[model samples]
Target: MSKYDLIIRNGNIVTAETIIQGDIAIKDGKIAETSAGQSLKAIAKSEINADGLHIFPGLIDTHVHFNEPGRTEWEGLETGSRSLAGGGVTTFIDMPLNSTPPAINKKNLALKKAAAEKNSLVHARFWGGLVPENINDLKDLFEDGVLGFKAFMSPSGITDFNHVDDVTIFKGMNEIARLGSLLAVHAESTVICDQLAQEKIAEGKTSARDFVESRPIISEIEAVRRIISYAEATGCKLHIVHASSRKVVEVINEAKLRGVDVTVETCPHYLSLTIKDLEQKGGVAKCCPPLREENEVEGLWNAVANGEIDVIASDHSPAPPHMKEIQDGDYFKAWGGISGAQSTLNVMLTEGYVKRALPLEKIVQLTATNPAKLFGLFPNKGTISVGSDADLAIVNLNESFELKREDLFYRHQHSPYVGKTFNGKIITTLINGELVFKNGDFKKRAQETV
Candidate 1:
């Protein structure tokens, strides 16, 4: 009989604590033990020689739009999860918009879970939508195991997922606080965006750059300040999703100083690419809380390094060719999203680690540990300790690869990072003791759980 189910040997195991040269032992889909500098005497059913590789906890991207049950053609669970796994993400928290019937109620939540179970290649946790009608449904959804709740202060791109006003936000925050669940917000004020957009339209400014200019950094900063004040008043644990401006970061930091329970996340796109990229890439580079100037990008990196930003997620919202319309390349009419689920790690590694000289431990904390801890999925999903789920990513830090849209695992063959080079590579991904990806191929069908 095999002494263990699997053993990953001769790898540099990197964790939030420290890096160690060790062999990881797995049994029944859990980490059994980790032995440093000693050959395992026990026989094992399988072994992977991970020589010269850096093993780290698999990434947990807490923000992604899988567009299932209604918008499958844009990006479905199967393609989205595959993209995540390909990027070395073992788990993700799916946002509750863009789908036909967003996960607002129990019925919608059930539909979303069913679709994910059938198609997802990774473990997925759902975020219940916060809307006027769903106020009564929040408890049930939280009881049903949703990671948290997500709301937009501005009009969500989809009409079905309506925006929440200050009244709804206050009520929802109170309820979320009662349940001890986090409330994640898309923090652009609708009234401000509407006024600015209308003014820009009247001025005959209808281009990608115009769109960006209309949604100024002040919009994000003001909305963030409002949310922080509300959170302080209501005592709600708040998470600002995809914060894109320096002012927002400052506000969040100040709120924390005053004893508010708030956290913030910024996407890889915000840290790596600036608004200037939008000029050349047009619609493909567009995103909500649109990318900012180079100086703002620098400030965001400083925040990440200085421990102001809590997490780094991919905000992986993908759209079909018709929505993006790369051929016509009209920014004003194109959908606002960037597809980079499969390049999150490499992009961050290239920019955050190599260029900015951020410590590898900080990268792990932001990408894996912090998200898992913030969303209440920690100890199980984020760490590489004994008795945890054996989810790991073996990365080759010295490897270099240029991102090509054609090379992405997403259904849509479009990416803003296309043609950009990356310094690191995810060589293998393991989920629950099973090698899901290795040598640029999936070893088994991904398993999705509720």
Candidate 2:
């Protein structure tokens, strides 16, 4: 006889393989058994009836900026974790740059971890920054339990976190490869983007449209090519983040076939929004490696559907309202980020599943399984099998609702998704067998803030 802490009955469990209708039993914060028959007649002290809902393995978001320590004013770790939980994410990996001290060394990483310990509501890992000054510290940071390292091939928006040149990237990649960790890059050529931005601003053509043009697909394509070559030469595992172009996906696929250890990630915005949305919504729609044309959007969706793209993350970088809402419409001065932490899964449901018939298994791979395996958290965090943590997101795929500012859990409720409608609403979320969130809870949090 097995002891049970919680039992979820009759849910269609979505996994990387397929969806199965079964009952799951949890004990000691881990899954104990799943039954499709009368294997276990005993009931747990707690139970959830999910007869018509979909139970999915918890999502792992590998790219996010909580901006703790130094930039808590922008978005604190507490609010950020709440946002992740509300979005049905059970685990998240925070980027290094937005916080003060940047997590480039042991002491800074310790500071960031300490803050997360006190504030984070779910599992939180971190990515160390790979900069010119910290090549010597890579060992210490990796030993400190950083999942991997992140480098910007172009100017990172933070003042102190400078972008890496080829020499710096090469050196960092070699060291990282030797340590057997991955290096993720924000791959947009600084030379192309910076030069064009200067020209655009100089000519006073600084609208969001001009910003998009200044950072054309060529900038991203050139940088992706350069970084992939570096990774191939150094044998470093490379990951390209927020890839927004059809051409970039084609090159990454070629690199993969040529046996370069590379993986590509495209954000939900790339699959859903286009330059037209940016033109209509203004700065809130602004982000680096700016949104592509409609055809490019379809291409990214195609890549996802074809399994060419490996992961889909929110890249949930947020800023204050004043930073995003500029009075003069000087788009260049506005923050180049989208408050997207809570709406990524929603977008995928609306655009990827309800609209395009993206297989549920494929969605699970992009959102959960691939990330867990990529970062060495698989089997423990990514699946719903025995001996795994009982992290689950149960959703009602039948319901549809329009998003609003008051439904957000961010410190600032100003996402560009406020007016968008989405299907597949999260019904309940569990982390380590404990109920953490339910539908309509975000509205309560949002009201309390007011």
Ten contiguous residues minimizing lDDT sum, candidate 1: 325-334
User: Candidate 1 — which residues are off by over 4 angstroms?
Assistant: 326-330, 446-448
1-450 per-residue lDDT for model 1 (tens digits): 998999999898877777888899999889999988876677799898888888989999999999998999998998888888889999988898889899999889999999988988888888999998889899999999898999999987888998998999999999999999989999997777889888887777777777888888889888999988899889999999999976798989898999999999999999888878988877788898888899999999989888999999999999987787644434566788989888888878899889989878888899999888888778987888898899899999989988876678898888999999999889889889888888678866546468
Residue-level lDDT of model 2, residues 254-343, one tens digit each, is 999999999989898888898888888877889998988999999888888888999999999999988887557678888889889887
lDDT values of the candidates? 0.87, 0.89
In candidate 1, which residue pairs clash? none
Displacement of the residue 243 alpha carbon in candidate 2, Å: 0.3
